[model samples]
Target: MNKWLQVSFVILTFALSGQAYTDDSKVSLPDDSIYHLDSEWVTQDEQTINIQSLSGKQQMVSLIYTHCMHTCPTIVATMQNIEKKLPQDVLDNTEFVLVSLTPASDTAKVLKDFAEKRKLNQDRWTLLTGDPQDIRSLAMALNIRYKKSDDNEVAHSNVFTLLDEQGRIVFQEVGDINKVDETVARIVSQ
Candidate 1:
């Protein structure tokens, strides 16, 4: 067969294969990427998505609960501080992810209310809740520890982690979130 006919046959075969050949090349995630987790998460907007869906941009993440009245608030404030300190371009590409430590109670509706109450702009922020096990798995991956009390209060560590586009932790603050804005800014700027 002629070269032109051979190329046409291959193209038609791929077209008939549907979405399989739509992409030119498949991008592989790193071994350490959290995006590899096969867990379903529900966003405040009520959309179901996997961690892999958040893979394309840098992420600033913290684990907090809607009912927390102590260090959680301070941790969120520190996250906001870092968010505000980043350059406009960096901020544009960076997303702030707040994962619920109490998924059993932090449903989509509760998360929405918390977001609205705190004036978290949906464009730059995402609030997520998932199965209890999925939440725990993610928390473990981030090295965030949490335990529920008799009063339904969760005592968790204060952690602010920066994840690069590949979903690998770039920078993390375990207990102290003070005076780390500059470091977070510098890392996410690239």
Candidate 2:
């Protein structure tokens, strides 16, 4: 009876601790935080989440569509390379976001297939597609520009943005991705 009572007490304590940790007692976000945007996004695995849900960890974000035959692939490769250069602790706490510039075509299923083919680590990488307007809003917020051509191709800016836990921009790399690893490590260490 004593052992059973102790075990029950331990379980209840853990349950309460978890609930408290997840409670809605978060501090208010600043005016410029990207998380303040009311946009709904679907992940590669078809889970429906939002920008705010991505708030806790540092976010390294890029814009790409899976079907692109040009710089988009390079962008993905660059993100993977950045992941390799991070220290284990920073890598574990950081999340990579790839937002589809062609959201009208890059459905959740398509994103999932792309992720599988590329062997992207689902635990650390998020491939997202959402309504076109939402994608545009996020792109504008991050200072990434895009225009769709008649050939079904998108001419887009090559920008990689880093957002801190509260969704404020820590750094943004434009065109040249070679510096991301070093910048990320330095900012995170500081």
Candidate 3:
């Protein structure tokens, strides 16, 4: 009975951890179902950018406000971690975009200051804040929901969408601070 109990314990452990060599495949997003960036966006840097602008580059899109005290910081940290983990080729071909949903609050100066404060590479990163209506429309199209809370706070989704060179969302991840490296790697491989 003791030997049988040991065997069961081992089986349970494997089941709980998922078999290490079970030939299980990772579930990837379909090419056709991805949400594509279709419209032109005005950047916080006073530049107009279109979806086709990223035709040859992979992009990671996330919704964040510079004023956010909690999750937004985590999102920024996660993005930095992903940037750090990418290979040189991936880093060269990829761009990180942060679209501010709080357009009424985060202005160009604010975004510029925030980017500088974070020491983000301006060439590889874009933090955008523009027309509130446009931001809302884009957020809805991307399926990124956000609502303003009390006193300059917001309750928002912590999702990051990785888009391919053709502007197709290849992967979606939530709570990126912990899984950012894996998410970036998965998208980079495709």
C-alpha lDDT of all candidate models, in order: 0.82, 0.84, 0.76
10 residues in a row with least lDDT, candidate 1 = 19-28
Candidate 3 ranges beyond 4 A from true positions:
1-38
What is the full ranking by lDDT, best candidate first? Answer: 2, 1, 3
lDDT of 1 at 173: 78
Please list all clashing residue pairs in model 3, or write none if there are none: none
- Cα error of candidate 1 at position 173, Å: 1.3
Task: Kindly give the stretch of ten consecutive residues in candidate 3 with the minimal lDDT sum.
Answer: 21-30
CA RMSD, predictions in order: 5.7, 8.8, 16.5
lDDT of 2 at 1: 62
> Could you give candidate 3's per-residue lDDT for residues 48-109 as a string of tens digits?
77645655677888889988887888888888888998889878999989988787788777
Off by over 4 Å in 2: 1-27, 175-177
